[model samples]
Target: MSETQMPAGQLSGNVLFYSKPEPLAKELHSKIGVKRMDGPFKFAKVGHAIPLTVGEFPLAAVTGPIIFVGDEKLPIAVMGLNAGENMFVKDDGTFESGIYIPAYVRRYPFVFANDEQNNQMVLCIDRNAEFIVDKGYDMAFFEANGEPTEYTKNCIEFCNNFEVERQRTVSFVQILKDLDLFETKEATFTPANPDGTQGETQKIAEYFGVSEEKLNALPAAKFVELRDNGALGQIYAHMHSLVGWDRMIALALTKAAAQQPQAANA
Candidate 1:
């Protein structure tokens, strides 16, 4: 399909892209980077839930055209893994090639819309129009011809299994929490840094009814590495930094176990 271009006024969808910096808010510059607003465009819509899910599991979604005054050519289903569903460019406004969303997000129920707010979108394209149809929902790199590009064996496989692990781990958390295996408790685990900044460990411990000491004692970072060799690990880190430790740890294990090979080189 020839790309459809809508006037700035007609752009509308459920996604929220970050554009401006609120000085009064606690802004973490290094982690969130600078939120760059579209230079001069004006938005028609005022209130909408940021179309991002707060869960640790990554979902199928699309981001960007990084619109200016006109419709810009953007890549389709260009496959990335665990990149935030909320779109943001690098500090320099460059695309972070590592971000990939799911094919279902790209193909159905239309997760996309655009406006001057952030002048960005999360789109829902038609099934036949998607590029990664054959690749299942795992995010990966594809060429113009729609073939998986070469990478380290584990990297390719990891991308291939991204969604599977995400779904599995998220489901596990829901089940365990529902079954009361993981209880919620008030915790002091989330502690302030030497400078008084709060850390996620305490929050995470509280969420899981454990002590921050107990949480810190778990081999979480190591297990995360074992699960996906660090793909899911970094995302969990991002979730922790922005969301909290409970989500980071939960998501890490989710992504890892979903991708765990049925049997290793035993």
Candidate 2:
């Protein structure tokens, strides 16, 4: 998507999202602290994505820099729309069906008034720069130290849970974690097949849009497995564009060599 296709005015604001800071909130404040703030944080209210417009154009919206309800000091990228809905409540002012209410309901803080109906966590960023896109996921946090940490096991398990080919099954968040695994030195492995020649491995590498050498260098076998399963294409595409086509190709070859097993049977 091009900048021109985005809404006319540059969005330059933020919003915070969480169950209210009350003890009665369904989402626990303490648990949020334990789970490392990570990516592929899709804009979900009821485990579903929210779609809205900024300056009159449509885009996927999600929460970013998620904070405990009480921490309002940090910048918030509030969605331009409020899609929260009313939950069935008990006499004591608590929800009856174990569902949670959103803070952005009613006179929604988001730019869109309709957004308040579904309890969706739609956030507004100043630009596309705030978001890191994936096939269907949106990134949520940026690590000040550097690139975010990888969740390799979570990514692999998530893919296997779907039973689809990795290309089709993996979401944007899964790929981000997988790549993080590589950057953080958690992954190692490369391609293997009936043909022993590394040249034969070039297709999967190209499918990832990386090169033969890069596909052979990853430290994690699962990364190769994902490549072999066709999960690396979109990642390769994005990285290639972000880092330059040639540089990304070289990086891929190097990573594949570093991560793949050297002793695979031909």
Candidate 3:
């Protein structure tokens, strides 16, 4: 995935949130290190949803809706009602306390690239990350001896574990595919009329999800198989996460009201 140098303006993968990713090498980046950032997660505001591994469903479900995308069929946690607006992210680029943040967001600026020639995964970093600096900073990528520093080692471990989780997520998706469990799903909201009646329903979102009807229809043996394989729990988590759509609608209403023009005193 990496080479002696990643040509200027060239990026290797389609990984989300990475810009100008380059392979980490002591020869090319010995002076480069990470510094403390003022608005660390501001970059995340560009996306309304963040990808999630199946392992994160239960924890992430409590915070927001987790649904599968059409193209990738991978689960993502929806954070905002509109595109390019991550409601969970503050204007200062910080996530609020006591909320579950996706690993995909926290692992920013670092990702793994496949080294095809060497048949291995190599560490890469977004060359344009605001936190990365040259010399005497918060943490160095490598020591002068051409070995990874403690901080770099920790980052490598985290990335490796994430890859393992990601692969496991793929297997989980395949299992669901085999069971024919996914179905198209939509979310909607209805406003209260001026008097008391409910207003017309409006479509809020459309995505794929594990259909409870299909899940219930599985043969006893097949149901047992899913339960034994630890997928049933994840399925329930996904289903439960749908409730978060209400939370999103509420937040969206609040945000919309804030953006409305105030009437001057009559």
Candidate 4:
């Protein structure tokens, strides 16, 4: 299906990472130039969650909670447990040092849009991006000869690679779904009170994750199929990523306390 034809419930709209995705064409190339991203990550401040391609699971698992979203089971690295807050992003707009940045976020300002009529994907960019420049910039989308530059070509290649990984992730999630191994789960956190006592437990978020029980119950034949298909490692990575939930809770409690100092002091 074309991106525009994606269902409202899907995360394809302006809400899914990119703010405004417009096809990059020769007609628009003259008006577009991108400055080197010199400062912190200004583009990432808009959203707390970043999408994850299947290949990023192992590295992302070490950085944050990796979970699936919506019916499509799109993988995402949870940067923050609460809305409008990202623990990984510092005040300077850069991610925390040494943390893994998902390719979906790194591919920011550029993406591949589905060309439904042609049944293919086209390269697109966010015109509203701050790094876009009209003139006096070393970076240019196209040369004076009207050919795409190395920078634009590199972006296309990156987007293409991400698209390939995204498709693989779709198949991975489908396998889990078909096996009925996914289950809904909620994470609760209880912070220590100012008096040095345990406080009330609060449910932080709800999400879908793999069920170990169901996976273990799978027939030996099915298990062999997953192993032979090279999906077993990914499944194990996802399950192991759940260990980051505790880290998320710790970060959330710190943010909560910082937001409500009075309660924290009480």
Candidate 3's error at 37, in angstroms?
3.1
Clashes of each: 9, 57, 2, 0
Worst 10-residue lDDT window for candidate 2 reads: 52-61
**What are the per-residue Cα lDDT tens digits for candidate 4 across 1-266?**
12233322232344465666677766666566887755537667655678887788889899877888788887888888778667787767678887898888788788776556556666677767778878766778887777788988898888888888989988988999999989997777887888999999989778898888999999999999999998888888888988888998877677776889887778
Poorest stretch of ten by lDDT in candidate 3: 1-10
Query: Which residue pairs show backbone clashes in model 3?
Result: 1-114, 1-115
Give the whole-model CA lDDT for all candidates, comma-separated. 0.31, 0.28, 0.85, 0.77
Candidate 4, run of 10 with poorest lDDT: 1-10
What ranking of all candidate models by TM-score puts the best one first?
Answer: 3, 4, 1, 2
Error of 4 at 114 (Å): 2.9
Query: For model 4, which pairs clash?
Result: none
Q: Find the candidate with the highest TM-score and give its number.
A: 3
Top candidate on lDDT is 3
Tens digits of per-residue lDDT, candidate 3, 50-88, equal 889999999999998999996669889998888878888
Ranking by lDDT: 3, 4, 1, 2
Query: What are the per-residue Cα lDDT tens digits for candidate 1 across 1-266?
Result: 11234443454532322232121111111121111233211121221112212132333122311100111111122111234322323333233454433332322212234434556432222222222234343333333444333421233344335435445545534432343333334322454477888867633221232123433444776445434643333234322332332333454456566667754533
The RMSD of every model to the true structure, in order and in angstroms, is 19.9, 23.0, 2.7, 4.3
Which whole-number lDDT from 0 to 100 does residue 219 have in model 4?
Answer: 100
Residue 88, candidate 2: alpha-carbon lDDT: 29
- Select the stronger candidate by lDDT from 3 and 4: 3
